[model samples]
Target: MSGFSPEWLALREPADHAAINAQVRLELVRVLAGKASPKVVDLGCGAGSNLRGLSPWLPAGQSWTLVDYDQRLLDAAQARVARSPLSPSPREGGGTSVTYRQADFSAGDFAPLIAGADLVTAAALFDLVSVPVIGKLADAVTANRQIFCTVLTYDGIASFLPEHPLDRAMREAFNRHQQTDKGFGPAAGPNATEALAQAFTSRGYRVIRAKSPWVLDQTFERLRRELDQGWANAVRETGAVPVREIEGWIAHRLAAQDAVTVVGHEDLLAVPV
Candidate 1:
């Protein structure tokens, strides 16, 4: 299993993430209504990023369960939550109670972990989860008549620097690799949003879908580097051409970013159904 490397965090670290994610959270809050505090489960809740964004809007009495298969990430998330002002202490208004579970949504059944939640959500998770697995999750949540929301899955396409020939080739190769099933019984990777939506709709979810793509410009240097690396790795994995040529392309592209245009991604927000 590929661990969540600092490289991943570096890519995710951005001032805009907090604001953009808050917007996504607010959208979910708008649709889910209940007088009593609702239970919430954040599947693949890495380091509690979404929790940080959602806690303010949720009622003080609401209960939360955070789940991630990675123990290191789960521990980190626990620590972050405990340190936040919203900690279960009375001073924080005691509006929300939180719990963290280290479990893989792919292997462990989510039904029990998320049972009875007014809302169950995942950010950038569905793209990595297989269709069969997603189907199971849809069944589990629908069986309980719960709402499910997933955001920001890759659409197997990303806009890239204009005038860069290698950029298009790399993206095409990576997207193809993303479509392969990674020993998970069912395929995941790219095109995940469409598949998940179809699964939920078929399972009787009233699906509400939206797009939230990342159109980061050269201003986002770190994100730009990560995107380049991601594309390079995919090109390497495919073994479609000479390794040296791919490396050369990556180095050249990275160096040429000053003038090269970059645009990539198709983000999707899918609600239950």
Candidate 2:
């Protein structure tokens, strides 16, 4: 409810899936390889995309707690888990089970869900949380001795080909704007992955980081256009450029339809020391 729309999330799900570091996911799956029916808690599990995306990489007996603030998203998530072929089916080994919870992790109490959890995971989430809250999550992971993995956190790398004069300025301003509160006082913005890794490391956990950037090509014109519009909106909101310039930038972006853009992201996996 407080985050992206289902339409946007659905539109980006495939890119998110492809952009996830496979090696990182393989390592995570390896860590929980021997566990019998691991209990996983996914923070901000919007529409169960992560579940569908990563479940196959994991063993069959995977059980997930898909937590989010919106009931509609949770319902959609439930429906997806029930119907998606990517999800473990009934006849499959052990199969996969899911439970939904409506709670905002931004400023909500989620310690209860971490208890007895084998893995605490989230995708595209760390950037939206504050430092103290991330520290609290680190403490909980240590207390429960659970694995923490987060993916698709923007790392401030944005590229547009046939560049415009305002490209760097607009991106820098937008990054600053990203720090504006998204429910967690001054979000980490581009520094999210580093902040989280540091939090777990200070608590004596070993962290693994991987690059998982989205490289949109000509084939992805629609997705790229939508993403560019989002950048335009972000830059506009920050008042970094005048409305006329912003419009011109947007126009240039659309004009360069064949341009390839790479949006950087990082994936993190932390395990107890």
Candidate 3:
């Protein structure tokens, strides 16, 4: 319910799954392989896309808790999980039991167990949070010696093929709008990965960072258009560009061959000692 539409989440899910770092995933799997039944808590889980993407990578007898502020998304996540190969109960051969909770992570509504979950997972979330919140997350994960795997955190990198003259302005304005408080105070936006990594590392956790940029070509026409429109809306929100230029830029970008967009994101895999 972070103002992100279900359509948008669905549109981006495939790209997110592909963006996960192979080496980082292997390291995380190795670390959790020893747990009899690993417990993973996904903060800010929207529509359960993270579960859909990562559950296959985990052991069958694991438990996953999906937390989000939006009840509607939670409902959708539960319903979708039921339909997915990762069913709610292990009895369904999913080898995983899924649970959903309506909670506000920014308000710190979770108990110690969630904070120190065996594996703390988040996707497309850190960028919307503040430094202090990330510090608190680090403290809890360190306290329980847990593994933290967060992916697709926006890193302020974007490019539009058949580049427009206003690309730079659009990106800068969008990034600035990203920094605006999305419930969390003064979001780190594109800067979240670095700040979160430093927080975890400073707390004695070993961390690895990997690039997970989204590379889109003409085949992904709808997703590409949405991304472009999303940026235009954000830039307009920031009042960084004139309305006429914004419309012109968006119109021009909408029609192009081999239209490719690389939106930069990073993944962090940290294991507390």
Candidate 2 per-residue lDDT, tens place, 220-259, comes to 6778899988988888888878989989988998998577
Model 3 — which ten-residue stretch has the worst lDDT? 85-94
Model with the higher TM-score, candidate 2 or 3: 2
Error of 3 at 242 (Å): 0.9
TM-score of each: 0.84, 0.95, 0.94
Query: After superposition, which runs of candidate 1 have C-alpha atoms over 4 Å from their true positions?
Result: 13-27, 87-94, 257-273
Query: Total clashing residue pairs per candidate?
Result: 11, 0, 1
| Superior by TM-score: candidate 1 or candidate 3 | 3
For model 2 the TM-score comes to 0.95
* TM-score of candidate 3 versus the correct structure, residues matched by position: 0.94
lDDT (10s digit) by residue, model 1, range 1-273? 534653475356452253244455566667654425778899888777767655666555778898877777777777766776465423235567789887766663778888879888776676667887877887788788787777666667566654456666777777777766654554577767788778777876666565555655666766767767777887798887568878887777677746332332233334554
Would you list the rank order by lDDT, best first?
Answer: 2, 3, 1
Winning model by TM-score: 2
| lDDT, candidates in the order shown | 0.67, 0.85, 0.84
Using lDDT as the yardstick, the better of models 1 and 3 is 3
Error of 3 at 181 (Å): 0.5
